[model samples]
Target chain A: MHDMMIPFGPAHPALPEPVHLKLFLEGEEVKDVDFSVGYNHKGIERTLEEMDFSKSIFMTGRICGICSSAHSTCFTQGIEKLLDVEIPQKAKIIRTIVFELERLTSHLLWLGMLGHEIGFDTLFMLCFREREYVLDSLELITGKRIVHDINIIGGVRRDIPPEMIKKVNKNLGILKDKVDYLQTLIKKDPLIKKRTVGIGNIDKDDVEKLCLVGPVARASGVPYDIRRTDKYLIYDDLNFKIVTQKDGDSFARAIVRVQEMFESIRLTRQALTLIKPGLIRNKPAMTFTEKEAISRVEAPRGELIYYIRSNTTNKPARVKIRTPTYANLMCLNKVLVGNNLADVPVSLASLDPCLCCTDRVTVVREGKEEIIKLEDLHGHH
Target chain B: MFHAIVDCVGDGLIVDKIKKYCLKKSPWIFHFCTGGCNGCDIEILAAMSPKYDFERFGCLVKGSPRHADIFLITGPVNKKIKSRLVNLYNQIPEPKVVIAMGSCALSTGIFQKAYNVCGPLDKIIPVDVYIPGCPPKPEAIIDGIVKGIEVLAKKVK
Candidate 1:
């Protein structure tokens, strides 16, 4: 059979985000895959340089809606390190609770999208329906459903009161049961197994070589969670298992995420117990030397790292972000090539590629792709 | 002869009324994200989920622009997507309503000072309804669509 090339959207039904993929097909099999991002680039890194250090935390929170708390927490943690300020214990617990709940919401959203991609709309509905509980809990804590800008430079913005903690715990109790049902449904559903099992298989060596992070790496039998290693926030004080699977396929990734959601529930509940009514924010006096600090947090997708440098002024000298989707994107060819054309969406969705987080800093110039250096990017302004 | 003519005219009027009613009742949506945070896009999806039940209004998010009646746009219009947004706007059939959701769509929101952004969406195409929030809640999105249907009903006439 002659080879044919199919263009899979900068805007396609299978993908809610904008990503263009060129798939070369030999009959029914995908011979090769080429993908291009930057359709969702908003130049956020450069925008960060112009905003105040305090305000930029909120700006970073808006980077990815799914993991807003992750970005802001990482950014704030970096800023705290730069300023040599340690947040209070209460603040630490609050940050951890928000961080983990954000994980639950992000993972649930990913599950729903995975179902939608595989033509299983029922699973999509069920996942989104249960997701409301998490969103409600987030709303109670942070005052917003999607973008919970709860983190500040010194610490968190909102403290979890006793009543709020009780409510959030109630939601987690319900979510735990729903997640259990989802786990069974995912495992027993033959169609889900057929679609996912052995598809998008990534081996342990490839994960290490490519520097994959989050569940994508864990699914390949790598216990490389930054939360466990770095012990950032109150993670070192809490006890939770790093979920992993040996298969390293799409199904393994789903299982890893679903199981991780249970861990998140446990972690949130533990952190809620740890919260004491002392102080939420330290109100650090804004002072800066020519100092740079790096912070890493395990966002729902994976490890999100932020580099923050501060000058004498209130504005940050520079801020750089490395999102998990950017790191996981390295395995796209491994996931897509050789798969059936029909399996492309399901396999790609399994990676949980957040193009919005990945597509920062590249600009198309006069129809030619150009990579802007940090200094040159500043020059543009 | 007069009675027969009256019956024909009455049937034509009734069909027109039904057509207008269906147009107002069930408006198919096409969502396009022009370079902003995924916050608004996800909220749009949440609005369609089981809890919000956006489909009860007979609204469906269509894959192709040709199949769309309401163009729901989110994000700041960046330079790369500016042309494509115009192309998509042109592809949708006439009597369509354009609803720009999110603060970024309204005025470029936080990415206002970014070099890549070319718009608040209105500069590229005329927008009929504006739903503003960093990322508006699902209920607000549904309200905006209901308002857009009103604008669509007027245009259908």
Candidate 2:
């Protein structure tokens, strides 16, 4: 029997971005995989060196749209810390609200993608249909749905208006019930379980070693939620359980996210009632000698960390971002092995991988290794 | 405004009716990411959500250039994606319309100075419409697509 090497991309239909994987196949089972990335190397980190500290705040949000608000908040928080400025309590509550909303939308979007990946178009449409409510709520509050642009240095840009609070309450109630219905449909739906259960199979040991965060890590029974480990904003004031599963498979990952949606609903409700009025943002220090701070926020995918260094100028000396997807991409090689070709898409979908937002896997293989890109495979077959 | 509209309308009820019908139905879209910032991608998604409801107008995002009638290009087209974009544009059948969304795609926005970036989508692709925003509002995206449908119908002549 002849062996073949297939590469999955920096661009693949199964994946939204360009993450390339080179798989060595022995009779259609993955024997080994080499990861390749860098197709989307826009020099984001390098570009930061030239930007001023003030401008860098907004610039960082462009890192990934799905988590733009998180990036903006995290970047500003890092700078604020460097300036030794404690954000107004109102800003904290607003950040929490925005953060949870981001989580809600991110998880729902991932679920829709998961459904679409497995060829379940109906479920995709349904999940997205509910996601619209969240978007509307976001737009009504922040004026923009995807990139809220609400977070700023010292605090948030806008405060929750009185009328908006009622709308938020009503929307949350509707979202809670609709999300519950969707979760039930997802859990009981035999087709989803059939396609997702035991698909990727990232064992507990591998999960820890990979250091993957968010629902992917929680699904593998790692109770290392950054929101818990590194308390930020008003997470300490809120009460919500960390959703997890011991199965360590795509289905488990999916379930964990679905359950977490409920927790987000709970958190959003708590935030609405608990949040009190105060200054949304603080005036930034006019000048800084030389200071650096690192801020980490729990994004929907996982922990989003931003490192900001200011050198007595409006522009930042250095801005570094570590998105959760970067760490998660490291675990892909370990999980892809021994999976059948047919199961590859489902397995890959488990990470809810967004190559655009996640790390690009770069595979290095030796002679007789024919590399196959995910995009090429997706296009061909 | 009426005079300008009448001038643009050109006394063609047949074209007007066809254009209106096309605008109301079958608004095909193409997604281009000039630079690979995925912010615009998510917003495009926001437009598709039940909240924004672009599909009610019969709009669908197609993967292939051939199937797409309207281009909803996101991101700032970088060096690698630049040539591929031209190739994709060539493959798209005639009567195609292009709409550049997001700041990066417009004037390269924040990523303007980056060495790898191919600033402004118009440098390579002929843009028929532009929706300028860091990430344009979802309604703005729908507006761009609707405008694109109108442009495509006009070109059918």
Candidate 3:
């Protein structure tokens, strides 16, 4: 029995933000694991409480940079739902296109990071080298790459340009070939195979109980994708298969993201063909109708949920965001247990946890006095 | 008289070597998210990725008291996150440069005039290099990093 349990981090090189892991170890194998988060909490939820309707849009986007588009989209969709306004079909299609672009960028980043974690430095470079094309294409089309601010409450902000369509088609071809080549490499590469296979195994039945989503749940063979199961935007019109694998391991998660990249291209091309000329913005309500609504989107990580309440004012009464990484983090305890300490980074990264998206909540035990931040974790570092 | 100056400078070898060393050493950067959005954070992750190679030049996004020779920030620094902006700027380690990569980090273009947004990265975070476009191209980011090094060299003794 080890006398002292070492706390890995609330701040460490392994993670961008602070996530504390209490490792109970007998040699290399972890006997028991305790994890706590909230170091990066910004009191977004509480802050949203004081903000108005339109203001909530920008606030929600801050939940996580990678999925900010999905966040804003979900928030705006929720507002539209509360108002019971039917969005234009053209707008819907554009929303789908932009959403998929965000997914592609996010997944590509995850792939590169996963490669780096296992010491495959060259693969990481290759992935980012290819990723620059997507960034350029997104910049050309949306006028910016990251927070497109494309989806508005009633519609999108801009129309897809003709030159942009050509760029998309060209890049789509390149991405397809790249994804195909990398898929083969990832499958047969001994280094990747050795590092990822069977590293993070979650029980099949535990998924429903744990409430996992996106690639993590799908990789476990749950076949639960928000777009397929709960269609949003133009997902109903676009035809793309949900990528999944039964192995429920880190490799499975990696493969799921790889396949999704191809699907994103197919969806984007179809969207481009389907997009028609129409008004990009509908007249936004001058005042809210004072109603509550829920909006969900298939973020690159998983189903992103946003709940907003408008109090007949420009400011929202409340805004709640359930980021995909938050839900996925719940299952980390199950995944991390009984695995070698070396596998910790892969398992955690496999969930693709977005620390920025999660609300800060931490329970610290020091000399039997537990400290809870309540909703005020924002002020603390 | 002119010939003596050229000879002392070693036929621009000093400049070329300095460019090479600084390009590989001090890549100062500023992070800007034009419209208080966070997507730039993820995109910047591409550079930080083992593949994109942000660290090859010893570049890092410093937090506070601006110890960073480069300002590598994310988001447009929303009204809520704006208060932290002063802290972020003050913490940057001296002789710094800033790079605003994303569109939101530039002008808050799409999200302009929305309630509760300070809007535009230049409002805060004194920017040096502006990589325009929604999320600026990664090559653009690298280019900005290189340019930042050049700018830093010119300012120094």
Report the number of the highest-TM-score candidate: 1
What digit string (tens of lDDT, one per residue) describes model 2 on residues A1-381?
339988775334565665567788999898888775555656677787787767776677777778878888888888778788888888888888888888899998888888888899777778888887888788887888777888777887788987898898898899899888988888899999888877788778887777888888999998878888788899898899998899988989998999999999899889888766677877877577688888888888888787778887767787767888788877877678888877787788778765555432334668787867545532331
Candidate 2: lDDT of A159?
83
**Between candidates 1 and 3, the TM-score winner:** 1
Each prediction's interface RMSD? 2.3, 3.6, 6.4
Q: Write the per-residue lDDT of candidate 1 for residues A265-313, one digit (tens) a residue.
A: 9999999988777988889899889999999999998999888888899
The sequence of per-residue lDDT tens digits that candidate 3 reaches over residues B1-157 is 1123334675476755554455347554445332233455555667665556777777765332333566655444455456555666676655566766666667765444444356477777687877775556556777777787777766543
Which parts of model 1 are misplaced by more than 4 Å? A362-381, B1-15
What TM-score would every model get versus the actual structure? 0.94, 0.87, 0.77
Best by DockQ: 1
Model 3 per-residue lDDT at B151: 73
